[model samples]
Target chain A: MTLTSDRVEVAADPRQQYEQAMAERWSDGVPLLPATDDAVEAILAASPYPADHALCVLPPRNGVATVELIAINAAMAGVEPAAFGVVLAALEAMSEPEWNAFGLTTTTSSVFPMLVVNGACRDELGIDYRASCMGGAAGRGSMTIGRAVALCLRNIGGQRAGETTKSVFGQPARFGFCFGEWEERSPWPALSVRRGFRADQNVVTVHGGKGTFPLADIHNDDPRDLLYLIAKSLAFPLANPYLGNPENGEVIVAFNPMWAERFGRAFPDVEDLQRYLRAHACQPIDLWPAANAAMLADRGRVDPEGRVHLFERPDQFVPMVCGGLGSLHAIALPSFGESQMQSKAILSKS
Target chain B: MRTHGVYMRPHQSYDAGMSDPATVWVRRPTAAPGGDESAPAFRLDRAVSGLTIGVREDRAWRSWQLIGDIWSEYLRRDGAETITVETGAQVGQPGSDDRKQIDELAAVVDAAVVGLGTCGSCTTFTIKDAVALEEQERPVVAVVCEEFLVHGQNVATHLGHRDLKILVLPYPLEARPDDELRAIADEYYPRMLELLGVAS
Candidate 1:
């Protein structure tokens, strides 16, 4: 029997009990908060989803997760149950077929799903997209929410090492990497609105980013120059465009509200900027060796012309506006080869 | 494997959330007692006789392209019939939405080699592709850079994959001199074949 979160009793000797359960497998390597039944129940009280509702059947280990199970993870996360429910919604979005967890979990890529929070929830959920928001600082809601998802993936999805599947050096994001778009501070609408979601409703957009790529253009204030610099940065040889078709992957540009507004004013609309980015985010075919070219050509993923745009179809280039008001900095979260950005509304029913 | 299951940080069960302890599942093998009759019976040599090695590209293509050619060369040296090579833009791309290509490839070939081709993030994807082939009950191995080996293995274990294996390469996907590239191929080919459980 366990106490509810409202009634959580400090476990009698929590430390010794934790030690006997399992060995540590994470950095900072602290004992995680137990996702007890009471904790889950408290968390679930904030969400509309049923306690027993199956959220996802994670691959490799195939850990079947229920809404109540997610709440347990959320309880451990230490965020308000309502905030935790938002995390749950994000996970639901990422589990879509296009996100391809079946192929992703077992693959050798270090890339994992990175959740980007946007809209009114940015403040409500307490995501820190201001300065130093990409991965450090250990904020509870910012870091733990991400970690809880990773825990859900590991404990629930069954992604334990050498047991179900294989991947090399799974990223810190595997532990949980999430942040909100600094919409109020941004110059334009949040990435959600750019993707067609309204500004009022809170939404979570899950991107299959292999890793976070920070773009610093201390020199270019000219919108075109800054964008051009960003375009060049996206064309890095190590980027997915080098190996896969641009149409299949994504390049998420996290702009400050100020910059977003400026870009919106400059480009006026999201598609125009996406078109400009899509046109500019190309690389010469010569950058790769003949063998790679042959492989790409064989698939028709690239054109016979040396020029290769990031996307095969114009829509593959995704433009999202987020982050703090401070200008001169942007974040580009690149996609993992075949995954898609999945989205769902934060359920208000609860 | 990144670490033995014994080292699992004592975590509370997902919904249980008891700080007291977790109802952790112990690690056990699935091998039957009949002298391993369930083990795959086909020899590595028999499997790759005319395999069509599919190179599934995610973000980094040069290495995968190189790997495909290397595998083709190695197989030819063993007198196997020509191995047809193919590549894709990977998942999330609209280019090849037939996400089941690994199964299709396994049906068409004796064995397959897919590469996240590089990095910890990308390698996980390659491992997924290899596991897909394994799901079809086909022989496959995922190749990744050395730095990501531990990460890849964790992902493999998390997914409950027993058969998936990773082939390691050095970091920095820049061009190595021809001889160096050859040496890498020479070192990893035998290791990969061994991992595929096909070294005869």
Candidate 2:
């Protein structure tokens, strides 16, 4: 493997590489690691697929994501070669027919793939599952792997912010978002296990999250009281759940480990907790302007009691135990409402 | 040290003094297959005149509804019967209801028209419905805002319908007034008919 593409070669120094890429408008305004031959080949050697193996044709640009191409971007993002499997798995999940990558890559909405890792690889890959897991953890896997995927979307898929993509106010997560579930601390099955993957399997679940909204509560010790308020917050009038048809999309509610333990003690079963959340996740119809309320009625969203459920089914409220052991805070990754969260197991090196 | 399951290999030193630095071996990304060559084998012949046309309006956009309505009126004036359908689902977010509506519409109409593929997802859904209509052997024309003209065509090719008929209207069509939309109707109507192969 060597630097052979038509892409111009400049001084191999990091400073020169940055200048060259920036001058060509290829840099995502961030300094990129030089994708030298040794760097790209090292990443490629970790892939189970052959260098020429075709992943999927990325949308907007319709660029074919061959293994070698993905490695180049991954290398530039400073991703560890061993974690290339997770990056590939995330891209495979997005290529699923249901994920609606074609729609997501080009949407005017500020949505991006929120990668959630599960299984033993979380520890192995150093995916952040503790304090500031969504960011600020400074873990290598959490930082570089997600950035690699984002660079692929930018360079290979050509999802330039204002030029190619109509993404109005593109969120910070667009740069790359990867987090892990605190599976050991959860009462129920881990996210991947519940999604039908083996407990030991490395899996990446990609969700089209528009943005993250943090929820905090200093009081209300009772589980029901806390959950009621949280569920109500999840059903914000302007959220994607209300804006688009809610039957297809799902939301992820990340509970700090302490809160998960409290909720688990009260409900005993995860389904029960999901049901309670779904039931209370509605707002009174009067909460919306009359015109909007009428529109909700037309979609069969508002009920006779002037209430509208956040989603069509209880299972649509995905609860995952994550973040630190803090008791007062949680987070919600609101869905884009048009796509499904898809999971793909990472391929073990053969 | 391999901290997380990943570890980087040490970089090979680059000689900064070399005049012709070795070319970087980045994988060249492949473009969409069969560009411009995958035109549909079937073109509209006499299927459009006195056509029982199904007009699909994506609910997310305001312009498509007006465009469909105006087009339907002109088609009706041309001795054709038009049945208009509005999707309950948001653009690019088709559900079972949307599929059912498109299927039912395909069964009854001789041809179909779907619009407002100016944005990302909406354009995908517009092509989706248009492909469904074509699958049923009904001639279909996907109308998109000029901004998404290439995108709509690319999606069609990706869906294995290389020759799908596409009508590109000016961009920012949604914010235009009724008179402007009507003028657009008058200007593009014949071109659309020609694309549909409506016989004089």
Candidate 3:
């Protein structure tokens, strides 16, 4: 198929091409593969949409993302032909209005899109879901798929560090973070299944995660007690959820396989576990200083018993099973408060 | 080099004694620049008397709330009916409600002042709320801090409301005493009116 994007001539040598990319402000401070015609065409062959179809308009600069443009960036990120569909799905999910791409892209907060995948493709694509799945997994799908999207944001969306995006203390995930759920190890239904996708469909859920907040415990064996601590830990006074409307965002709590098994024995239904966590995820109003207390009281966040709950609903505390088999740890992907997580099923050329 | 799973092939072959260095063709990844056309800006060129005015305040900024309250009092004293709406959320039910309120306020009010763009995302929403008023052909002024003036302008430009009127307040408006904020409110109140095209 004929490509419509503008083509520029660059040096043949990899080292020279790297310099050219740097000079053009196309590199994310890392060397990227050349997006040659062959490379871009390979990625385009895997897309469900035509070359000129506009997938979405990304914010910060409000760039129109067409399938061809996406493929070029994906090729630059070295995305395999088979994995191009994941990148497309992620962009589609983030474009959903509830995801609040406009606000998240321009916020001073350190929030960025964190990709969570589910379904059968996780193993085939090497989307790591266990043993340092959040990082250090060196999984191809996790690494390249995430980077492709990040590159799209930079090149297609025009998301510059201090200029377009006002993110203060931008986190490492800005470089790209993608991981999957260990569906087999989880006692609960797969995240995509719970979100209403089929078990066989490859799905991507994008969360506007500020950063990963780790929670660990080895003392309590009782599921309820350990869950209580996890809930309390999630309700940290300065969390974004506590700063704004409780109905706005969800905090993703990723549990290790061992903890998931134990918790499953205590509460078979995931909804029941979520309800229990929500009930306890609150802080005494007295925890904050006078000024903060006044704000919470003004917002009507303080209940009659003088407690400030993190969120209004139980489902806001989303639980997923992933990470190493070793117990004593869970990770909380805190929300941006103004954005809701969105999920889209990956669609490939049939 | 192998990148994750994709194996990238070399762009071109190099000869042992090539007279000229070989080059390869690649697509430029950046999007085309946006259009220069901007939406029309409205103005009230009349006296404030007998006109209903709106003041949009952010729940996150106490300083802006104090200023908004003072401005509301000033507007009422000048014989204009004032409606004040405080918004905090940018998405979900709260955000939807907030935007609905802005639209409703835009429908009734002759002119409005939308504010508290002291932070990044807030500035974007501040411009957005002001644009809603402008969309109704009503005079509106978006208020932002000195630090975020450019950012507010950029958001306005990107939203195709490049000519939207903006009023700049002092930076670090937070943590200041009420009296200091009151003085600031007193100082910028007339400028806010001017930006709204209020008659002298």
- Please report the candidate that would top TM-score against the real structure: 3
Predicted candidate 2 versus true structure: per-residue lDDT over B106-151, tens digit per residue:
9999888877687877887788788888888888888988888777
Candidate 1 residue runs with Cα over 4 Å from true position: A1-28, A102-110, A129-140, A158-175, A184-189, A196-199, A218-220, A284-306, B1-85, B93-200
Q: What is candidate 3's lDDT per residue for B1-200, written digit by digit as tens? A: 33542223444465789765677888889895443579899889988999999999999999999999999999999999999998988999999999999999988999999998988899889988998889899899999999889888888888888999999999989999999999999999999989888886
| Tens digits of per-residue lDDT for model 2, A1-350 | 54434343455566766676666555778988777677888888888987778887787666778788888888888888889999999999988878878789877789899999998888888899999999999889999989988888887776776655778799999888999999999988899998999998899999999989999998899999999999999999898778778787789999999999999999879999999999999999989988788878877887878799889889889999999877899999998888889999998678
Task: Give candidate 1's error at residue B39 in angstroms.
Answer: 11
The docking quality of candidate 1, as DockQ, is 0.15
- Residue A324 error for model 3, in Å? 1.4
Candidate 3 chain A least-lDDT 10 residues: A156-165
lDDT of 2 at A261: 93
Please write out the lDDT profile of model 1 over residues A1-350, one tens digit for every residue.
23222222223355743553243331124466655565556777777767667777665455566666667666655667768767777778867877777666655567777888776666666676776677764556678778777766665665664433355566767778888776665554566776677788787888878777777766656787778778777877666565555556677887766677667778876677777887777778777788766755666656556676666554666666555557767778876667777877777543
Q: Per-residue lDDT for A162-182 in model 3, tens only?
A: 777888889999989999999
**Cα lDDT, model 1, residue B25:** 30
Error of 2 at A281 (Å): 0.9
Off by over 4 Å in 2: A1-8, B1-36, B41-49, B88-97, B100-108, B131-139, B146-191, B194-199
Better of 1 and 3 by lDDT: 3
